[model samples]
Target: MNHALKTYQTWLNDSAVDEETKNELRGIADQPNEIEERFYKDLEFGTGGLRGVIGAGTNRMNRYSVARTTQGLADYLKKDGQDPAPSVVIAYDSRNQSPEFALEAALVCAGNGIKAYVFESLRPTPELSFFVRRLQASAGVVITASHNPPEYNGYKVYDGTGCQLVPELAEKVTARIREISSFGQVHKLEQTEAEQKKLLVWLGSNRDQEYIRAVASVSPRSEQMKSLAPQLKIIYTPLHGSGNRPVRDALDALGFTQVSVVSEQEHPDPGFSTVASPNPEEKDAFAMAIRMAEKEGADLIIGTDPDCDRMGAVVRGPDGKFEVLTGNQSGALMIHYLLSSLKETGALPDNGAVVKTIVTSEMGAAIADRYGVQTLNTLTGFKYIGELMTRFERDGSFRFLFGYEESYGYLAGNYARDKDAVLASALICEAAAYYKGQGKSLYDVLQELYRDYGYFKEALISRTFKGKDGVDKIHSIMEDWRSRPPHDVDGTRVVRALDYLEGIEGLRRENVMKFVLEDGSWFCLRPSGTEPKIKIYLAVRKTSNKEADQALKQISEAILTRID
Candidate 1:
């Protein structure tokens, strides 16, 4: 018998397995392909943690997988020796089984004699990171798939510093998880017993209030917000996720009175029925918000993802139509606003620095350079940006003014180590108000930045690869690109090639390749860490929008042709 088949059979026969789960297994037993897909391998607990389709299989995210992963994390924590009473904070977003999975993780921790602080209800991922440091917990776990589809759910871990576990620490946890063979063998305590033992603690509005107060500190011009917020019309949608209360509360606290929520997406819906996907990056996610904004004559529309860590926005342009701002454009707007605001208020630090991923546009860096603030680059993950923040705290060298990615992730204050949409939402609105006070829209300010700096445009191409074959193809593509990088792209000679896998330019080893063209444009290709996708990032700087658009299209076409 095949190993997977045998494993499936064993699962069917195990008394410890719930009948419902076994019934699911029985339903798929006749389908060998389904059986193979489910039992071929254990669901991996990757660097940060597990993210998979919620289902009843070794390769899926279920209660058993959640418990097992948490048990392994518990064991690792014990070995790592955090404190006498090691503790972990847990938060869940609005997704099917998010609450159940969170409780299961907490039970596993309690079973290991570790204290677990769990939110009474769903909260944003950034709050989980913030409270991890605020409560002095050993670690934190957020149950969410972020902006992924409804069928998907995830478990992400954060260190005491409130950043996702770096490579070294993640390796330790992954190794510990591998040593555990059976998900069925993972021990967990009953919820009642855990509560009675005082190992389980519930976090509530107190934490939420503190988190909102911290978000208020990100406001650029509070006085201006007090005046302009009432007049500035804004529309926001959480997309049936966790951002409803926090995002709204943060804005209201900052005196933004004209804010309106999309009623259809105001409450948590596990299915996210209103949108095709809950990702804010997608235009569909903003449909309801845009319509609401149009009806209300709002100046801006903002949407947050499932976990509420990444934020996306749309602004009414000069053309009298709403246009969505790419993450790079919004990032540049925030950077320019932050530095310029600080300078105007005489609060700009001498040792201030802005951090961004290598794939992010250079426009923000250019804006920072003009302000005499230093700009630093990191690998593509917010974890890397958070890691740099930790270093900054320890060395007291550079004050982290802002950190962002080409994706919709942004961070302004150090209150939370991760990308914070709640804070970003407030800062973005304040920036809008400041610009509004000047008789302009956020879009206008962005245009001014483009004119002041060069016209910088960026685009991304993500190709999905499913199953084992897809994984191999992604690896092959990355390897081929790394080994033989393009010498010229779209008639522009390649100036330099940086293969991150070779650990060049002081960056840690990663499977990413970058080609810089003589025209000062660059493109990078790398495999996504959490998803089964290969992403290509392209950016170009030109004197005009037409030239930039042309250069970007040509370079992107050339790269796609090579891939095909």
Candidate 2:
């Protein structure tokens, strides 16, 4: 029998496995394919930690897997030992089984004699990042799959600095995870026992106000907002996740009295019944919000993902139709708004700088250059950005003004190390209200930006591969392109190529490739760390929006034809 088959048989015989799981396994006994899919391998504890379909198997996300991963983390924390008893902070989003998994993780920590500070109910992922340092805990864990579908759930670890564990730190945890032999070896404690021992502590609404206050403090145009907010109509949607309360309270605190919530998506529904995917980046996620905006004649619309870390915006364009702004467009608008506002007040720091990923658009950088502010580029992942922010605070080499990526994720103030939709929501609305007071819309300002900086266009494409065979195909695709790279497509010359697998440009080694064209257009290819998908990013600049859009389409098709 295969290894997967043997693992299935062992689960059937093991008394430690739960009765419900055993029954589920028995249902699949007649189907070898289902057995192989469920037991192919332990759900990988990658750099971002574990995420998988919620089910019963070594390769699935269940109570056993959650506890097993938590054991490794507990062992790692206890290895060096602490002068004081070590503690951990835990938070979860409004996903199915999120609350249960969170409690199980807390029990594992309690069983290991570590104190656990768990939120009383669901909260945004960034709040966990904030309280990790606020509570002075040893580490943090948040249960969420972010914007993924309802059937999926995840576990991500954060270091003491309130930043997600980067590659180096994550590898140590992964090594320890592989040492545990079986579910029976992991530890657990009863809730009453944990509470009696004072190992489990519950957090409540007072902390929510502190987080909301911190986010509201990032509003740069609060003075103008107080006077103009009542006149500016805004629409927001949480998409059936955790953003409903805090996002509303942040806006309410900022004096935005004219705000309206999309009633259909304002509450927590674990099924996410209203939207096909809970991601705010997709236009379909804004369907209900748009109707509300149109009826209310709102000036702007904003939505955040289930975890409330990523934000998406929609505004009226020159043609008077509602248009969804791409990540690059929204990011560029924010950069210009922030720097210009600072310049107007003469508070723009001389050593101020912004950080973006390698795949983000250049328009933001171009705007920063005009104001004498510097911009730094990092490899993909907000964790890199967060890690850089921590370094800046430690050394004070440069003032960290902002950090963002082209995935609708942005962070403004240093109060939190992760991308925060609550903070971004406040800033974006303030930007709109600030400009609206000046007798111009956000779309009008975007047009002015295009006139000053050349028109820039960007596009992103993702191809997913599933199951065991899909993994082999992805590896083959990466090796093929690495060995034989493209030089020219339809007479376009490739001026330079940056292969990051060799640790290019003071960055760590990563399996990513970028080809820069002679006309300043470029495209990048990289495999995602959290999901089984490869992403392609493309960008170009031209004299006009039409020309830039055409070139981007042509180049994207030429590249896709070769890969697909």
Can you give the lDDT of residue 367 in candidate 2? 96
lDDT of 1: 0.89
- Best-fitting candidate, scored by lDDT: 1
Output the lDDT of residue 191, model 1. 96
- For model 1, how does the per-residue alpha-carbon lDDT over 324-435 read when each residue is reduced to its tens digit? 8999999999998999999999999999999999899999999999999999999887999999999999999999999999889999888888999898888888888888
> Across residues 305-382, which tens digit of lDDT does each residue of candidate 2 receive?
988999999999877778998888889999999888889878799988899999999999999999999999998888
Alpha-carbon lDDT of model 2: 0.88
Per-model lDDT: 0.89, 0.88
TM-score of each: 0.98, 0.98
Backbone clash total for model 1 is 0
Cand. 2 TM to true fold: 0.98
- Cα deviation in Å at residue 16, candidate 2? 2.1
Give every collision pair in model 2. Answer: none
